[model samples]
Target: MYCVQCEQSNKGGCAVKVGSCGKTAPVADMQDVLLRIMQGVSAYASLAAQKGARDAEVDAFTPHAWFTTLTNVNFDADRFTALIAQALDMRAKAKACAVAAGADLSDLPEPATWNPGTTASELAAAAPFAAIQRFMDRDGPSIVGLRNLVLYGLKGTAAYAEHARVLGHEEAAVSAEFHRIAAFLATDPTDVSALLAQSLAIGALNLKVMELLDAANTTRFGHPEVTMVRMTPVQGKAILVSGHDMGDLEVILRQTAGLGINVYTHGELLPANAYPGLKRYSHLVGNYGGAWQDQQRDFDAFPGAIIMTSNCLINPEIKSYADRLFTTGPVGWGGIPHLTGHDFRPAIARALELEGFTQDAPEQRIPAGFARNTVMGVADTLLDLIGKGEVKNLFLIGGCDGARPGRNYFHDLALATPKDSLVLTLGCGKFRFNREDMGDIQGIPRVLDMGQCNDAFSAIQVAVAVAGALGCGVNDLPLHYAISWFEQKATAVLLTMLHLGIKKIHLGPTLPQFLTPEVLGVLVDEFDIRPTGDVADDLARMLKAA
Candidate 1:
């Protein structure tokens, strides 16, 4: 199996037995087959779309199915087997739609026509020849690397699009782009310029997805506002909701509203405390734990039920908390109870049966809810401070947090910023030093928590507003970025930054293993993307540049 779509790929690339994220060779192979089948479905779907015959179910399924192939989302081979069959059936329906519309289908690729059997074993056997890497033989490393960039970016975009879809938000153009890219990859073209254009196009598509999600979240929950969330546990039966799904979290909060169970946010859900509609619940206590990578230790020590709503679910730690663990939406495992149709009663019952916090822990608090609206609310204040030179440098430091070493660089860099500068953080990466006492510059807090990684939209809004107020391009503003990434969502966000002409981003922990030197050189030369260096050195360089 060969998978380098994530930062944690084993020994640079998972080219041998299994993936570093605990994905078995069989599961990885099955995932590859599923992706190939998805391309076939897309092949027909795109043709059907061209002929003005569109299927909403087929359009929605494209992102939902693609989302399951993302890193650490699904590990169950049986699940992939079922999805493969579904894709095959969908392909037939799409083909019928295209033929009825009088679209020609004679010149399709193997993925658009071949059926690799029904069983898991059959799919695994076909994986080697069917995988995207098969194009490396004809396309070479640089082109293959660029193709993978587009592929991973699409996976990230699909994940966000699925989240938006769950909330009754859908754009026909976004769905069309998914089918467009899927059909593009099916052909395995070797033109480097075309592939690069596709990469940036994915970035542009992702911006739309993020905007849709931002609207979905804000419209449903109201814009996030400043709120102090209790970091310590309170005495009660508890349920912790993790991952990036606010809709699932809201459903859980509703069903458990009058049941005397306390619903707590964990991981990316930490920002839920700041949303007006969600925080209005009296029993939705506070955030627990730090990041997804620390869940093994955190969940084991927790005294209540847990439900993972989205990505970053690992396999090795399930046995430690499997009896109390549940999954919903696209997140799945072989044994975990999968909640469907937003019925979370089983999870709530489990939480009721388990003992929660026996007594209130010592009180501690951290702030959240500084999304786009909140930041812009204080824009005049921010700009006035910048003009007065009270705030000289603005540092945006955050992304996905992983268990791998060297992440302490972000922790150290966040602490090393000048007191006059403000630190803007989002995603799980903020757990590194979010609790630190950075005080405030004038009346503005030094560290601003800008919702989840899903809230990168908010960060982008803040950047653009600040730059426009200063009468300069975003790249010319006195702002610096230190981005830490672990998965494809971060890949999509990085591409969005590049797409906006934001330059000189310091990205690290490690560069993506899928990026060959030639491709990395292009990013470095074109966008001035830098691999992070020593904390002091990078900090000094950023300050010097400012």
Candidate 2:
């Protein structure tokens, strides 16, 4: 097995017995096999869609299949086996539709026509044919790395598209583009320039997905308002909802209503408190945890049932709370109780039986809801401060956080920013220093917490708005990007930044292992991207440039 899809990959790639994310060789290899089947499924699906033979179920499953393969989402090898079979079935249905539509399939690649015997051992044997390391051995590092770059971006795009689809928002064009790219991968294109262009195209595709998610969230929940969320726990039977799916959380809130259970937000769901539709629930209490990386300790301490709505799941082998841990949506572990169709009665029953917080803790709260609309509502104030030179710099520092080393740099960097500058943060990375008091710039809070990682769209909108008001391009503004990447979503966001021609951005704590030096050089040459250095040095440098 070989996997370098996350920042915490073992050494350069997980080519041994287990991945750093706890994915075993069997599970990892099977995931590759599932993706291989999906490529064939997509090859036919894309052509079928072009011939007006689209299948809605196949279209939806395409994104769902890709999203399941993302880091920390699913680890059950049996789950991947089921998905592989499902992909083959979908492939047959799509191929028949294309054939009926008079589309040609003679020139299709192996992914579109290969027949692996239907058995676990047979699928395991086929895994080697799909292994990415084999691609690296066949085609050199540069070409393979660029293709993986595009593949990872597609994974991120699929995640966002799944979120949007659950909210009743989707576009056929988006799904068609995803299949087109997957079919392209089936051919094993090796042209570096063409591969690089496709990588950027994936960036543009992810931007559309992010936009769809933003619209879905805002439309369903109303624009996030500036509100203070309690950090202290309230005494009651409780269920903690982690991950980034508000649609799932809303369902839980409805199901558990009047059941004397307190629903707390964890990780990226911390921002849900500011949404009017969600916050209107009196039983919906406070945020209890920091980020996804800290979930083991957090879940162990919380005296309630836990529901993971999406990715960022880790193994529960060492935890006693695994019994009470529930999986929903695309998140799953080998033995955890997987909930479906928004029915969370089992989790609710467990929460009622368990002992929740015994007493009301000391009241503490933090501000959230500074999404694009909220920020733009106060744009005149921000613009006036910028014109007067009171706001010296705008530091956009946030992305996925991990337990890996060198992450302390983000915490230190946020604290080191000048008092005159505005620090904008989103994603789980803010959990590092978000609790610290950064005070305020005039009437504006010095630290602004935008929504989740998908809300990187909100950040981009804010930057472009600021730049337009200043009569300059986004790069011409005094905005310094110090992004921290942990998984493919971060990869997709980075590509979006490059696609926008945003330059001189800093990324860390370590670069992706998949990128060869030559490909990295190409990105650096074109975008002026740099690795994160000393916090004090980066602070001084960004402030000086401002």
RMSD of each: 1.3, 1.1
Task: Name model 2 segments beyond 4 Å from true.
Answer: 11-15
Tell me the tens digit of each residue's lDDT in model 1 across 360-428. Answer: 999999988889999999999999999999999999999988878899999999999999999999889
**Cα lDDT over the full model 1:** 0.88
Worst 10 residues of 1 by lDDT: 11-20
lDDT of each: 0.88, 0.89
Per-candidate TM-score against the hidden true structure: 0.98, 0.98
For candidate 2, lDDT tens digit of each residue in 159-214?
Answer: 99999999998998888888888888888889988888988888888889899999
Which residue pairs overlap in candidate 2's backbone?
none
Highest lDDT: which candidate?
2
